[model samples]
Target: MRKSSSLINIKEVLLSTRKVLNENAIIDSDLESDLLVAFALKITRAQLHANINSPISISEQKTIQNLVNRRIGHEPLAYILGVREFFGNLFRVNESVLIPRQETECLVESIINYLRHKSIESPKVLDVGCGSGVIGASILKYFPNIDLISIDISPNAAQIAYENILKITNNNNFHVLVGDLIESIKVQVDLIVANLPYIPTKRIPTLQKEIFLYEPKTALDGGTKGVEIISRLIEQSTKILKPDGAIFLEIDPDQKYILKNKIQHLFPKHKIKVLHDLSGQERVLSITIL
Candidate 1:
């Protein structure tokens, strides 16, 4: 909170940001400081380093301070930056969609790895609850020839998803639908990927402020049991999925056992594989029709 003259240099601005965020009890203050500084400077992280000693203009310093204020107000860093990196690519994001998380990358990777050896060509892929189109767009980026269809119930989210997909891959092979899960898909796909709302109604209040306060509630609430949307997807997949098609679901670590049981009771013949993320937390459930 010093005069703009004293906070002119990149280092000074970064230090100020860290101080303010730390005072606000923000976790990852260091990384958030760096991101806010780089974003305000309109430079990459490496560029920000290169200009460490360079002077920040009065306007840029004010911009950085404003960004810091937003973070202090519990706004997510991604929303402040207007983009989030997922699967090694940056996708545009806003309050309309749930910010993409690193754990979701596992879902994309699993699908890519599975398809690498399979004979399926132009596999039909559906991304249910495709917020910001990260999952579908990333999949199509890796497998350009596959037919990709992504749907989200939120129109705001659907628009952003469309923009992201078109931004990443200029190809016309992907389709974006703005509707509920299976209702939006008319064709059966070889694979379906979803990162639907899994947070239980009771637990939503306990979520971090960066999430419950800033992110869209529709994208996080999963009704009373938390498995409502996932359960519906399981039932609907039976109608659209090919005989050997698979569904890869990104879920909260604690929901694995109950989800497994739900899937088992619904589809008794399918094989369910629960996959852990890098932290070894149960993250993805790969269900294949046997």
Candidate 2:
């Protein structure tokens, strides 16, 4: 974004942003440019299109320039804008929590489908590492009678999840616990869904800078083999879940066997199934107690 432009309109601002970002090899430069412009105008995407030629005030241009500079420095666009949409709802996000990914939505979908198919009325649900509260919150929004307890080890993540849960639904049946895995809970649940930290410790450095540098390590690192936190969650869930309860987890594509083996070794009677996202990549782990 050139600061020396005399008079700028929304169209010119977006075009300039796209050019600068594309030049720097930024992915999705066009979408990022549109979102930044919409954020600056405080308007919806539809409104942005209707007023594409509207003039941007001098103050607004300067503000957008600052955001552009931040993005140019490899900062996440979600962090720069202060929000990200997940499962069709906007979630407040910062450096404290991982930005909700589209693939994780498969975890939510699998849980919903299981609950409905089994006709599990008043299902007690536990969301482990519930960053932004998107997973559990989406469930509660659809099933108001469902009991949900969402837990995260990070205080900032817990706070953001709490706020998102409240704003997303009026259901008071959900609880946000700030703790590691299921250590903070005593009661058994009908289902458990986790999007835990499963990235290998050594591979964290190999991830995109936006993830390794910007996101919290506690919410990303999975210890030596990338199953430390996930292993703990499965072990604890076996004790706190009903005999016929189920657990769903989001994981890296390569983690399918390692995670399943852990579950089998810990809970030999449990049944496990791997699910793939729309792109046909192995993404979620579904475990049902026998």
lDDT of every model, 2 decimals: 0.89, 0.88
Clashing pairs in 1: none
Task: Give me the displacement of residue 181 in model 1, in angstroms.
Answer: 1.1
Candidate 1: C-alpha lDDT:
0.89
lDDT for 134 (candidate 1): 93
Model 2: residues with Cα > 4 Å off, grouped in runs: 1-5
Q: Which ten residues in a row have the lowest lDDT in candidate 2?
A: 1-10
Candidate 2 lDDT over 1-290, as tens digits, reads 44345767888889999999998789899899989888888998789889887788899999889888888888999999899998999889999889999998898899888888877768889998998999988989988889899999888899999999999986778889899788979998999899988888998999998887798988888999888889888888868899889989998889888888888888778888889997889999999989
Residues 4-66, model 1: lDDT tens digits? 555478887788888999999998999999989998888888999887888888888788878
Q: For model 2, what is the alpha-carbon lDDT of residue 278?
A: 79
Query: Which stretch of 10 consecutive residues in model 1 shows the poorest summed lDDT?
Result: 1-10
